[model samples]
Target chain A: MNPTACLLVIGNEILSGRTQDVNVQYIARRLSETGITLSEVRIIPDIRAVIVRTVTEARAAYDNVFTTGGIGPTHDDITSACVAESFGVPWVHHAETFRLLEAHFAPGEFNAARQRMATMPQGAVPIRNSVSVAPGFSMGNVHVMAGVPRIMRAMFEEVLPTLPHGTPVTSRAWHATGLYEGALAAPLEAIQNHYPTIDIGSYPYRLDETQRGVCLLCKGTDAQAVSAAATAVRDMIARLGFEPYEGEPAKS
Target chain B: MNPTACLLVIGNEILSGRTQDVNVQYIARRLSETGITLSEVRIIPDIRAVIVRTVTEARAAYDNVFTTGGIGPTHDDITSACVAESFGVPWVHHAETFRLLEAHFAPGEFNAARQRMATMPQGAVPIRNSVSVAPGFSMGNVHVMAGVPRIMRAMFEEVLPTLPHGTPVTSRAWHATGLYEGALAAPLEAIQNHYPTIDIGSYPYRLDETQRGVCLLCKGTDAQAVSAAATAVRDMIARLGFEPYEGEPAKS
Candidate 1:
């Protein structure tokens, strides 16, 4: 099997519901395109003890653990020091990282708070954030990144090429309006049984204030099976007298 | 503190970078609005052992644990069984849940695979899914939900009102575009020193085509202190000759 990976999202703002974690979907979608199955994802508060315990556990368990959030210039941004403590490594000012920040800012612009962003666990290598100079770091199995969606996307894109690839997963979707999931239940199950290797997901959606339907999504490595299952679903929907809308070919 | 909540997103599709986890941000934003601090989030594979262990451990460690994904009818969808096993409870078809399914699906549609969605741990209460009838469930401290973003959001909206609201968390965001993080180091430190209670976050964001800025988001229970710090951030951004964007007023 290809190497597996996990993600740890550390932040109180996330759990408290102040911030929407856009990174997970971004990461999930990106990883899927590259054939890496992100096995698990976790979000935690900005607590040092908890961060240390989580980072250590994930690193030991998974081949690679990607963490987002909690690496900013604020006190709540404590992933760096906690990560260092988890590995029993010293938190040091990364020379190249500091230089990047120095070059980006004017004289005396880099302060202790900003300096906090540069501190990484001893022996960690900076993962280049091509969009912004604030570097994400990788030490052993853990890769720490910014929580901001745009920056996180840039950071992941920078490192994605290096990760291992597995079976490329593909998906197809069929949508039917004006019918509830109950109406499509039998045919959907029949379609799933025919394609044992594929995963058929039924999502009931509402639109335009009145119409309702279940969008049946089939995903698998076998394109033929996915296409067949999707076609079956669309045909079934048509038989029910409702026209089905198959989503444009997009990464699920 | 009211009660701590954590979101566990389980899927191999997320880790290997095949999928981006939007649930973390969704759950985080929802929980923060309700004053429940999300302590941690973990994403794991479809393995039963891992899911069981994590569920048991998290239930013991935190007040509430919300799990998303892996509750569908597919073979990999084993969260319900694992969660039941974790609690040492028998997985049985909940009558009400089955009724909901029956209402939405026909008798032929209610096959073994589709019926799998109705199986819940003994003594579990079904969380309403107005969007779909598969129905999420909760027993003891765990809330098992669907992985799809649309379903997860709907489930959260239904579940949030039932939980106890603790302290109301308030936040303010002040942005400074075109100023690198390195330049505002000292003043940011001074501001942190000035307001110990407010949790200040600096997120560097780059617009699609142009413009780079760090949105300094301050969060806490204290309104005055948060405002003072936010004002300080805006003033500092102005001093640096960078345009700033302040977030709108609190909704609740």
Candidate 2:
């Protein structure tokens, strides 16, 4: 079994529909490549109690818990404090982080709010941020990063290399235009049962008038099983009287 | 307090980072318009036990629970069964839904997988799907829809009217180029304290080399309070040295 991970997105903007999340997908793909299974994701508000409970629960449940957002130098950014409380540690200023912040900011620019960015839970190790000077931190299994996509990506890249990895997941897809998922479901299920280790999924797309069909995806840690399942899916699509195409068909 | 809603996104593609979710924003905006407060969102893989636990918990916590994905005629699609189990109801074929499927599919096209789409928890009412024939269902306060963006939107539109609403939230925003969120945090907290009902947020954006700043947002059900908080935020930005512009500055 792959090492499981869960993402906790702490932002009101995402919940308010003001900002569309780009972090989840980026982290998901990266985790997959690192052989970590992205098991679950929770998009919660900046409420202290909620954040604390979620962080604690996720830390216990998954091998790694990644939290994005609410790490900025703002009043609503309470993730660090909540995370500290979750771990029953003091939220204290790290000397190195403070020095970094002091060097990054202009004269008199580093106010109390800005100073908040330098604080983290006791015994937390900082994750380097390439985009911004303020670093994300990791305590135990919980990794905290900025909500901004650029900073989050940089932090993830820096932190991921240090984490343990399992067998990387491999995937193959076959698409068939004019083929309905209903007709393919039974046969697909049979294929899935035959290869219990692999995961087979059918995604039907009908974005435009001309483009409509189902894309069959087979994914697993076993590369050979994935390939075999993909071949079976293609054959099934052909048996249903539709030409099977590799990968998703180009949307016109 | 507004009537609360929680969204449950069930899919492996999303967890795999193969697909970026577009349903959350659409649902969040729609819920805001309908005077429903979107409290939390959880994205879980196509796991039956997890789905059942999440659905049951969400139903108990919020006024309405909306689920997207895992409702298709495929091996990975197990949402309906899980939802039925969550509610402790029998997963039975609805006569009306079966008839609709029968009418939509060609002769012999409605296979066992297609038939799965017609099954729902006992005592569930079907939500109309204008985009596809397979109807989403509403069991009590839980609304199940397709994971596909287009289909999810259609089902949400169909089911939203029946849900109870509260006072609609209104928002105002101000943007300031070269202004740091750290400087604004203290005063912003003061403004938020003054108008306890309003939700004040600072979102920092960095696009390209030159475009970077914080966007201050004031949102509440009270229009006057929202406007007042916006004015205060603008004033604070001006006091700090940068000119505050209404709404988000055009991304350049």
Candidate 3:
């Protein structure tokens, strides 16, 4: 079975709409490619109790829980403490990380605030990234990651090879212009019912008032099933007097 | 207290990274303006049991619950039935909606699939949008909207005026270039502690290689507290010999 994962985005900025979040899409795509099922994603505030409760729940509910944000040195960055509380352990400064960070900064620059980055739950493993000196850590099934897209991607790269893998999920899609979802729903439904193991989806998109289309996609770990479903989708499109295009339609 | 809200985005497309969601930001910003505190946002797939459970839980937890996606004519469109199950209500065709949709389509064009669009839970109120003939519904405090951005925005606009609004939450921000968050974390924490009613956040951003900075934001229901926090943040920035700009910094 493909291991299920949950992404918990812990921050107030996302909920307040202060910043447009690009991290979810990046992590979601990476998880998909790594053959992990990203079951759910949540964006919550930086409150301590909420973070602790969410981490405890998510850690048990999914095979893996990946968290972003709240790992920095600022006051709002409380993921480390909350995660430790959730695990019923004490937050401690890692000897190696403390030494590395202390040496990286100037004598007086390594103050109390910057030193907080070197702390984590006891027995946690560090997940290093190229973008920042402070490392994100992994405590049991939960992987803490940086919120910035560049840093998060790098940390994910470090964690990817370590995860338990399933067959890599892949997809096949067919698209046709000037088609309405209502007109093709029945046949599409039939195709979906036939492929019980794979997921068949119909996405209706409109580029402009003059341009519209529906893209039918089949996704699964089984390569043959995805391809077969795509064939059926293409055939249905052709039967309705539209030229079926392979893969997603180009956006204009 | 501001009326708390939760936005549940239900679709497989978003989870599979097939779509980059714009709905969350739009809803969050509108809720902020409407004086509703958007406490959480969740993205879950289009499974019936999951939908039913999530909807039921979210409706009870928050004062207002907003949902997007899966209100379509396709086979994956199971939100209507699931929502009804969540509320323990019967899913039935609305007489007016059925009549309007039947009249809109040609005699043979309105098939079983198209008819599903007109179905909703008992005692649900239709949320009309200018973009489409099919209506989204508001069942109690749970407002269901379309997946398409244009349609979703219109549905939200329809629901906006009818919602129970709270005191509008507002923010004041000061951003300065060539500053590190580590340098400001100490003073920022002090400011946050002083204004216990408001939220003070320091966000570190990198613009290319040479440009890196921090944006300090103060947000709350109280305008005076927000303004006071902004003054402290600006003073901190100037003390550190950086010229802080009001609002956000230009990304050039």
Best by DockQ: 2
Write down the RMSD of all candidates, one decimal each: 4.8, 1.3, 1.0
In angstroms, how far off is B228's CA in candidate 2? 0.8
Model 2, position B33, has a per-residue lDDT of 73
Q: Is candidate 1 or candidate 2 better by DockQ?
A: 2
How far does residue A245 in candidate 3 sit from its true spot (Å)?
Answer: 1.1
TM-score of chain B of 3: 0.98
Q: What are the per-residue Cα lDDT tens digits for candidate 3 across B1-252?
A: 988999999999889888888899888888998899999999999899999999999999999999999999999999989999999999999989999999999989999999999999999999988989999999999999999889999999999889889899889999999999888899888888889999998888767788999888899999999999899999989998999899987653
lDDT of 3 by residue, A88-179 (tens): 99999999999999999998999899999999999999998787899999999999998987888899899978999787889998999998
Tens-digit lDDT track of model 1 for A53-86: 9889889987888998877776567899998999
lDDT of candidate 2 over A47-118, digit per residue (tens): 899999999999999999999999998889999999999999999999999998998889998889999999
**Chain B alone vs. reference chain B, TM-score for every model:** 0.89, 0.97, 0.98
Q: Which residue window of length 10 is worst by lDDT in model 1 chain A?
A: A243-252
True contacts kept of each: 0.52, 0.86, 0.66
DockQ per candidate: 0.40, 0.85, 0.81
List iRMS (one decimal) for every candidate: 4.4, 0.9, 0.8
Residue B157: error of model 3 in Å?
0.5
Q: Model 1: per-residue lDDT, tens digit, B1-252?
A: 657786778775565444556777777766776778777777777778989999999999888889988887755678999999999989999998888777776657676777888899999998887676788988888998888788888998888888877876788898766765656766776888899888777666665466666777788877788899999989988888887778732221
Model 2's number of clashes is 0
Query: Model 3, which residues run further than 4 Å from truth?
Result: none
Task: Name the DockQ score for candidate 1.
Answer: 0.40
